[model samples]
Target: MLTTLLYSPQDNSLIQGDDSHIAQWQQSDDAILWLNIDGELTEPLQAMLKQTFNLHQLALQDASRDRHPPKIEDFGDHTFILLRGLSADSESINCDNILLAMFISERFIITRHSARSLSIERTMAALHAGDISLATGTGALSLKISRFVVKRYHKILFDLETRLEQLESVMLTTADDKVLAEVVLYKTDLTRLRRNFHYHVELFNNLRDEPSLPFDSALAHEINDVCEHQHRAASLADLFYQVASDLIDGYISISAHRLNNIMKVLTIITAIFVPLTFIAGIYGMNFEYIPELKNPYGYFIVWGVMLCITAVLIWLFRRRKWI
Candidate 1:
């Protein structure tokens, strides 16, 4: 789907249309154009991007792909940026689910994404509500959209931290297979998020240090703020990954300790029964006649002997603190 929003600062009017309005928007000098493309890049849409916007072929190719790492490239007249956006329906921290490709220039900004992007939706909503004024400049507009994109990570990271705390608490008493599985899943998710956030940190840092277009002081400040946000997000992801690792190690240690306690109890029981089993074995042998069979009190004597032996073993084990 293709959607266009043209905002004219002079008249404070907004025009919402499709691809057909592109020509008219291009003719106006006092308007800021925001073109959003969702889903696959069909041949006709690709042609229009090349002919109408004059986007670089290489940049278009990268945008057309299903997956690409976050990056920024300065093309003399415009800047091409590939950013990973969180999918609206994503349940985990998988950054590959949505890729947003942007071409930003002085007059217009174009965004392409393979999936429904919450960041794009939020920005569009803000634009329609008059909360965001593109009259500032397309550079500021791009930064606004980027800011929305980065905001999506905040809730996800907070939820992840909450889950880690819960799991840690649960692990204190029990480390079952299910709990272990969850820990593993979280670890994997955090790893992916860490890598994604790391790329974003680098991308924004590059944009801040060496911008493709000249940004005024305000825009430059905004870029710096976004870079700091990216850096903070990356650090949190790394920290969470480490926490997940520690959880796994703790689970292993707890499991081992439980098994050792079980084995120790079994060993103590076996030790206490060994002598009794030996005495019983001796009497059970049907030789011409065991001497004990000739006496009536032999059975009671055997019982007393076995009980005494058990008591001694128990006392010895307790004295050694082995039970």
Candidate 2:
């Protein structure tokens, strides 16, 4: 689907239309157009992008890909940026990512994504609600959308931190396989997030340090702010990954300690029973020359001896605090 929003600041009017309005929007020099392409990029849409925006063929190819790392490129006339955004229908922890490919120039910004994007939706809402003014130029509007994307990472990181804390508490009270599995999953997810955020950090840093077009100092500051946010998101992801690792390690240590205690108890029981078993073995011998077996009170004596032995072993264990 193609949705276009054209804002003409001179007349102070907003026009919402489809692909047909592109030619009309392009005729006005002061009009700022935002073209949003959702889902797969069809041939006609691709053709429109190539013809209308004069986007590079390579950039269009990268934009059409299902998976691409977050990056920024300068094509002299326009800036091409590929960012990772969260899918609208997924949870924060186990959410899927959608690529938000943008071709931004002075007067227009084109965004393409394979799936619905929360960041794009929020930005469009802001534009419609008059919270974000298109008169600010496409660069600032793109930054606003990038900021929204970074905010999603912040939310995910917060959820991850909360879940890790809960897992820590659960580890203390119980040793469940499910919790371990979940921690591993979180670790894996955080690893991926950290890598992606790292790329985003680089992308924003590059955009800030060397922009495609010479932006004013105010726009440069906004880029710096977004870069800092990306850094924080990446750092948080790395930290949470370590937390997940520690939880797994702690769980293993707890399980080992429990196993060791059980083994120690079994060892102690065996130590106490070994000698008793020896005496019983000797008394059960069928040799006719056994003198103790001839005694009338032999069975009672054996019982008393066994009880005394048991008492001694119990006292010894108590003194050593092995229990």
Candidate 3:
């Protein structure tokens, strides 16, 4: 679907859809125009965007793809940028990439994105509510997008931290392999996201405070907030990775210790029984000359000796604390 919100200076009125609406918005001086393209563009839609904006071929390709992490391109007439907005619980949320392009002219401004993410949606609503106090022109749109993206990141960051903590708690208590595997799974997901966000760190820092980026003073503040959000997310992801590593190490160490203990007990039992087995074998031999075989009472003596030997071995084992 195609959606457009136009703030026209001619009548100080809001116009809101497609090519004709955009053309009307474009004619108005000192107005902000937002174009939201929700899905894959059909041939006609592509043709419209191409003819209307003269978008670079590479920019269109990047927009067509699932998501472009974060990058800025200089297209001479305009600067095209792809900003990645992360969703909560990627296991449940789609990793949809949002492309926000800027057409900065002296009087009119235009922004475009492939999807209506929380970032753009929230901004559109604010702008529609006629709360000029929020922001104005392209600068205001940039501010809203930045604020919304960062705010979403904050919520997701909380979730990420919670998952990390819960996994650590489970590892400390039960140390179940399944729980560990889950931790590894989430950690790996975070790893991929971290790489993506790391790219944003560079891209946003470069984007931030770019006086030439058409951000007004108020919008610059919003950009700063965005930078802070990216910083916090990156830091939390790094910490989560470290925590998962520690958990794996702890699990392995405890398992190894338990195995060692079992082996030690078994070895001590075997050592204690070796001599008794030898003594019993020697007497069991069918020899007519054996001393214990001739005497009727020899049986009791042999039994007593065996009992005494077993008791002594048990005592020694207890003394050594090897049992």
Ranking by lDDT: 2, 1, 3
User: Weakest 10 consecutive residues, lDDT, candidate 2?
Assistant: 209-218
> Model 1 over residues 1-323: C-alpha lDDT tens digits?
89998888889888889877788887888677889999898777788788887888889989999888988998888899899878888655544458999899888899999988888888888888989878878888788888878778877887888999999999989868899998898889888888789899999888888877635566888899888888888888898899999999999999999999999999988988899999999998879978888899999999999999999999998999987
Q: Write the per-residue lDDT of candidate 3 for residues 21-129, one digit (tens) a residue.
A: 7777557556666677766656676666667767666676776666556777656555566667643233221243455544443334445555556666667677777
Task: Name the TM-score of candidate 3.
Answer: 0.82
Q: Distance (Å) between predicted and true CA of 49, model 1?
A: 1.9
TM-score of 2: 0.95
Instruction: In angstroms, give how far residue 30 of model 2 lies from its true place.
Output: 2.3
Off by over 4 Å in 2: none
Better of 2 and 3 by lDDT: 2
List clash counts for every candidate, in order.
0, 0, 0
List the candidate 3 regions with Cα displacement exceeding 4 Å.
42-44, 87-116, 130-135, 209-211, 216-218, 286-289, 294-323
Residue clash pairs of candidate 1:
none
Report lDDT (Cα) of residue 317, candidate 2.
93
Clashing pairs in 3: none
